[model samples]
Target: MFWNGSTQATIQMSTTTPLLWAAFRGAVGDQLPVILALISAGADANAVTRAGDSNALMLAVQSGSEVLVRALVEHGAEVDRAADEVTPLMLAARIGAARIVGSLLELGAAPAVRIGKYTAAEYAWHGGHDQLAELLEVCAGAPSRYDQSS
Candidate 1:
């Protein structure tokens, strides 16, 4: 029972069980209703995909859907969990999704989370998002790189 890309069929398919597929579909399609329903039905918000080992929250973040990201977080998604070294906050910052970054921070995502040797703020800076870098720095309780007050 492959997801026919329809919300109804996607929800009805028993094959999308274990909640991982449902979460991935809901996030990829930006379907808040489906996401909420799956979560309410005991879907593991942190369930990782076999392909890239990414969870629903990571998918939502990568989709650039702030609403979906927030919804997943509210549903108990692990904010700091990383997929291949990239945390949700890092992904958001790399994409320059300021709203998603803010939401993750508000949900207790640690801005200090490092992917390899770089932190989320560092990733934002590298991505040319000065404001986002600053925001992450502040959230991590670190001084902004833009600050020359040293």
Candidate 2:
């Protein structure tokens, strides 16, 4: 915990559950409203998986739940916060969730970041997102050393 002398602050160690991770997985099975309610019930929106592998935002993005993504963003989930390996924008790109990808982009999600040996752009390309790849190129016009190097 850290106190700036005016308030309390603490970090939630990476200790998320299977159900919790699944709930954010590709937004595949998670009931958005239910999960949001869970947050109300003390669920950590930024929690990491049991494997310490991903956060709620990543799950929602990969799951392509733009609605949930927006909700998490609105609730203060960091757009670039990552678990050990995956990231929300990476997940969204991997799943070809364009809207979610765009949402993250608008929220300041980087177009390029290494994820377990692959960049977010690479993830989108491998995930069969030709459009997304093009979008990445467009979004990252005049690739920087990071974009090219990655």
Candidate 3:
């Protein structure tokens, strides 16, 4: 343990878990080789960070890495899992990651799932991804405003 002068508190330094390191790398860079190695060495793909705010797949979705996202899902990450009230599909749509959203859909992410009052399609529309929003709406089997106009 060490004194954190900035926070005015004592902070215990611990070795970073493979999952946490992979999540951080997923968010900032596409370190696929390293992540795959860690996974092969027994890292749990579904493991969340200490704060319970992130996992490798969530960060991969946020980083817009479709391959990384798919790899994590195939390796046992829950595609529809939510962290801090936000699902991976919700994050993908909010960030306008069409391909990542598609991958998540193929991996069984529920298009109709919602955080509070909004679904993934709503997030896509709010993010200015009209075509993606329409796609998600169709997948969810919900009639979209775009359909009403046609």
Candidate 4:
């Protein structure tokens, strides 16, 4: 039981059930109805993996589903929850998910949060998403390290 010492073991176990698995998979597949049903059924919007990382919001970002992202956020997902130093916003920026990025920002995701040596803007820049980088920079209210002219 990797979750032995965690206070959320019950919730964690509940998340491991087939129903929750379906919810997670549906979220990844951008199936809004499945996610809606699971959430309405009392599924933990913030439920992490067995390792206690990567929630539905993070997965929704990876899936590039702005709808799912909005649903998760509405269900009380932490917009800034970091998974391996990368927040959902960072992941969205890296993938050039402008809609998702905007949704996260509107939900109060911090633009200045750093993942190691880079902010979300830096990650977007490194990923060759100039527009996303610029968007993140504007949200951060700070200039990006990479020259926009280049």
Candidate 5:
């Protein structure tokens, strides 16, 4: 995906069942209880689809649920997993979930990590997600200071 700076970030991402279940929670809007049940039943929080890209995080962002985002993160989803050059944050931005973006950023989601080679900023801009582009830009803009060693 590439950022084009509008509000329609284009992406090359994907997902499945366990990921589907997670995404469903967001689709229905506020179904954490069900998600929690699935998790308890052995849903692989980290399970990626056939291409190994797009996990539960992708769904959470797509669904725009901060509660679900936190639940997934707390459940041990890989905050940094990538799919076809698309990261969770990238997907979240594509969907225009500002809250999800902020939450992911706070969780340490990489701001500079690229989908293949394109950064989230590039994808956000390309996808026309101005707000997302801005958020990703800020999250990835700095070196986090801690990352720059003396």
Candidate 6:
């Protein structure tokens, strides 16, 4: 989704399950233990909110918690899946989360994939994360120093 000139994302009504909500809160709050407990209780890591705007993995990336990201992915979160047209890889790259980006790549996230006209490399570049942009470009098979800002 395109930004609406707001620093905050548009909040949407949520009909998400309690387990899902708890997991999401855990991710967002950096409460990994709670998330792990929920996971053990059969929480679906891929379950999204009613608006389909987010999931545990997305929240974890937004929180910049690599451990939470890894745990969620290991519990079956799809790294390349888009929420609000943004992939976890793109989010991580945009935030300059190098470790999380590396983890997502190891989890089989496709560096060449895009949401609309935006690639992860392009997101990184637009966010002023040059190193992440270069890394994503190289992973996508583009030459080093490839300009993704176009």
lDDT tens readout by residue for model 4, 71-136: 888877788988777898988888888888999999999999987899899889989999899889
Q: Please identify model 1 stretches exceeding 4 Å from their true place.
A: 1-30
Per-residue lDDT tens digits for candidate 3, residues 1-150, read: 343463311121133476655555464566777778888999988877666776667878876678889888998899998888888998899899999999999999999987899999999999999999999999998998767566
Clashes of 3: 0
TM-score of each: 0.78, 0.68, 0.82, 0.77, 0.72, 0.79
As a whole number from 0 to 100, the lDDT of residue 137 in candidate 3 is 92
Backbone atom clashes (below 3 Å) for every candidate: 0, 3, 0, 0, 22, 0
Residues 1-108 of candidate 2: C-alpha lDDT, one tens digit per residue = 234343311122224553254455435565776767777777776766555666778766656678788877776688888786767777777788888888989888
Better of 2 and 4 by TM-score: 4
Poorest stretch of ten by lDDT in candidate 5:
6-15
Candidate 4 weakest lDDT stretch, 10 residues = 18-27
What is candidate 6's local distance difference test score? 0.79
**C-alpha lDDT score of every prediction, in listed order:** 0.78, 0.69, 0.80, 0.77, 0.69, 0.79
Give candidate 4 regions above 4 Å deviation: 1-30, 145-150
Name the top TM-score candidate: 3
**lDDT by residue (tens digit), candidate 5, 1-150:** 244543321232322474555454585755788778878898877766554555676767776788888888888888878766678877776666678778988888988886566777667777887767866766677432234462
Name the candidate, 1 or 3, with the larger lDDT value.
Answer: 3
- Clash pairs, candidate 1, are none
lDDT of 6 at 11: 37
- Score candidate 2 by lDDT: 0.69
